[model samples]
Target chain A: MTVKAGLKNMVLKGVNLSIGYKLHGGKVLHLQKELNMELRAGELVCLVGPNGSGKSTLIRTLAGLQKPLSGSVILDGYDISAMKVPEKSQLLGIILTERNTVDNITVFEIVSMGRYNYTNWLGTIREQDRKKISKAIYLVGLHGFENRFFGSLSDGEKQRTFIAKTLASEASILLLDEPIAQLDIPNRVEIMTFLKKLTHISDYSVLVSTHELDIALKIADKIWLIIPGDKMLIGTPDEVIKSGYLDELFGNELISFK
Target chain B: MSKKYHTTLISLLIVAVICLFFLDIILGSVTIPMRHIINILFSRTDNKGWEYIIMQLRLPRALVALFAGAGLSVAGLMMQTLFRNPLAGPYVLGISSGAGLGVAIYTMLSGIIGTGAGFIISKLNYLGQVTSAIFGAVVILIIVISIVPKVKDSVSLLIVGIMFGSLATAVISVLQFFSTPQLVQKFALWTMGSLGDVNWDQHMILSIIVITGFAVAIFLIKPMNALLLGESNAVTTGIEIKKTRYLIIISSSLIAGGLTAFTGPVAFIGIAIPHIVRMLFNSSNHKITIPMSAICGAALLLICDIISQVPGRSIVLPINVLTALFGAPVVIWIIIGKKNLRTSF
Candidate 1:
């Protein structure tokens, strides 16, 4: 793992980033601040935190979907704020928590949206685009479900479809917001395992915010653990576990980690 | 829907539209013969009276019906897609109500200013009404659109829209109360929504606005498709949500406002035609639905216009009455019959 870390190149870096929302009257509701972090190539990093621990804010800030209250995020050595949406999308993909309620859209069409930046003004899918879409659907194990309505899918299938959509972009980095929050145990395990394999197969960096710490610990190369009102704890899963911060933050009299 | 099947369906719709167009022209008060109508359109006809009736009145009215139908339907589709609310339509959004209010205010102004200014106002009638209606629709749309981001959900936005419509109606009532009886009757007639009221000059303006609106909607095909996944997801896919929203609002207002200006708040067609197209096409891809909705809408309106004329009789019913009679039931059918709506919406 140390040797693998040595070979991995840094894909995303946050320098002195502050994550929060600004309320009215020029007041800033700070969540976390001055935290520097790095996501390396071919690494699946899990961001585990309690509810309202600013995990989503961090993910959104990192994805460039929301602005950082202070400091900056660098993607492939370029400032993310300076890049156009298309240019940023080419390098970074985001899977939001919002359920796609569009009932008439097919799985194929939903997956095809991943190629938005690559498609023409008419969004006409060429030969290359078709191959990418098919490959993405196949990657999610939804090969024959292309023409099926997205709303007809099981929760696991739907989440996999979203993952497929993110993959179809050919983005070097992915930021998923609570991807498996609504899934069953099997689905969660399946998604985490797939994400782990994906990082191993390709030099794609994944930063997924999830509450499923056990699955994340089993699959993630690095853990970004937010302990609330304190600096985030980042290290290998074993290292984080050994630090005793996990027990101090999450353990209780009735429920404690072994 | 497969590509081949879609092509077949589209061709059938085009044929239906053509048949309806001719039928609309032929079945007016006099019931002009189909061959004579065809010859009147393509070549000279010997009968001056028939030629004048077909050319001057029926032809223009049919043309108005065609454009108005297409415009209103496409506008409704845009609203439904943009808000992601199946119930959303131009009328529901208070766009037409705004137009009605504008015309009411104009009539009130004419009444207050008396006969000295009445002649000038009447002279400026269609142009004045069109400008005011467009202005009013745009204002209401802007208000509704600006509130979109602030609202928590589409249900709230829809409620806000309905409230705005009610507000406009209330204001129009006040104007009607103050206006002269003659002006009130004129505005009332306008409210019933007649396609035959528009002259060639007014039709030319309506056609220009509606076509421009359609052109804009076509340009929005890609962004709209991206938006089907909802705005946040659409943004991740590199769609500029603000710009797309503005374009959609502009295009919809142009079409809805222009149609209302000419036809006086023709209802049902705007809201119903999109669902019909969606059901017929079995797909929500904007490319297929947009053009298909336009064609289907045109055909529906022409049929409505024919029915409104009350064929073989001198009396003509209001266009709004027929559209509501047809459109409401179709919408109900879509809701109840297609249980897939829960999935699609």
Candidate 2:
């Protein structure tokens, strides 16, 4: 499946990206340097890495939450950092790892916030916005739970609510950080399957970071494997696994490919 | 709750506020009849004394109570949302102590200056006290705003605000200890929180300030709702976090500081009203919570003022005492009713 060069299907592109933090004393703490990547429309890309491998940092940089040490993340042919907050948000939706602490807010209210950029000054949800909000909630399989309190939801339900919120944002690209970290095995599989279905059914690109390598291997159209020392291995899961990078990355003792 | 239900609840609260306003006017130390009150309000009465009592005294007092209640509650709701803590209120951020310190300084200095009982001195005293209170509140507000950026979490910022309040209280106490007995008594009376202290002139100023604060809060409803999801999410949702925060701080300061300047920091209404409204509506959308809390706060404070008047007796209880006595029990009941206390936090 070769992508045509002149088409606008490339939803995200990273060129020579170096992601890390700059210290207070004018020192640069570079995590990963000189990285190039591209994600197309309708592709489910999984970013897998062990703990402290800068998976979150890379995602943050790509989502325009942090400035890369040296490169650019292009979303829809525009540099993400150069775009204004609302403009960037319109193109890319981000689901963070931290749990929201708001109480007494309903699931509908949380989902409706995804239409923040689209709503008027008063944030009045018009008919069109309502349709999108309900569609997003329905897609996340929370159709009848609109009025339920957000705080009363279980961990998996909360995760799904966040996903619905992102979906309601109507962004072409979705960047999620450890979305399934708190979910059980069934939930993890369900969410991954849902993401796969989303990519196939809709013109959306998903880049998810996870520690669940088994799920990533089974579901992801493309895998971004980041190891320690800023090493990045990107390919189809079978190619990466066949090349024995997966076994080497996690160690043969922890995981083996048949 | 459904949108229709929210609309109905808001309408009910507004109606309750109107009824409470009339009740506040009718039941005072003088115990004027409801019919007489209506007559005074609607038609010119032959009794100048009744007219003066209804128009000049009770009318202004009731209006002051209404505005102060709404202002303080709105301020509290904003602070609670800003800090993401249910207990956060107008006074929790040291604005009240700053106002107290201002009054303390004014009374003590006026005592030392030997301003004997005269018309000019009385006028100066009223103006000086309100001006000083607003100044002190703004100073503390600026300090808190500056420190907010440096603090890591809402809990730490809350602790810092508490410490600031205690520090201001200590300074006020020191001033009180050294002042004359008469001056100390005057300051003590001010600390008791009186809705009756506001004259028509002061009421006009307070109404303008409170209305402005509410307007600013209304403009911030969208950002405030975004903030409920937490700061990071709020930012990602295209809310200008710093701008929204600054607006909230300014509005909170204006509402709380202005009311405290005139009314001497009425207790419990700010902290209690928002929680009550949240529980009643079973929703946290700021669009619903802000207006409903304002109306509920006004009604509750009017009821408290009526209770303080002790209908049959001439001697009135301090407004603060009645509020704390009534509000604390409701809060306790709410806590006990909930299975998980984490929602309040």
Q: Which stretches of candidate 1 lie over 4 Å from their true place?
A: A1-10, B1-4, B117-123, B138-163
Instruction: Give a tens-digit lDDT track for model 1, residues A181-252.
Output: 999998889988898888887767899999887888888999999878888999999998898887887788
What are the DockQ scores of the candidates, in order? Answer: 0.73, 0.56
Residue by residue across B54-139, what tens digits does model 2's lDDT show?
89988898898888888898999999988888788988888778888888887888787755655566768877889899888888
lDDT of each: 0.87, 0.85
RMSD of 1: 2.7
Evaluate model 2 with DockQ and give the value: 0.56
Interface RMSD, one decimal, each candidate: 1.4, 1.9
Worst 10-residue lDDT window, candidate 1 chain A: A1-10
Q: TM-score per candidate, in order?
A: 0.94, 0.93
Off by over 4 Å in 2: A1-10, A23-28, A101-103, A242-245, A252-254, B1-8, B115-120, B148-157
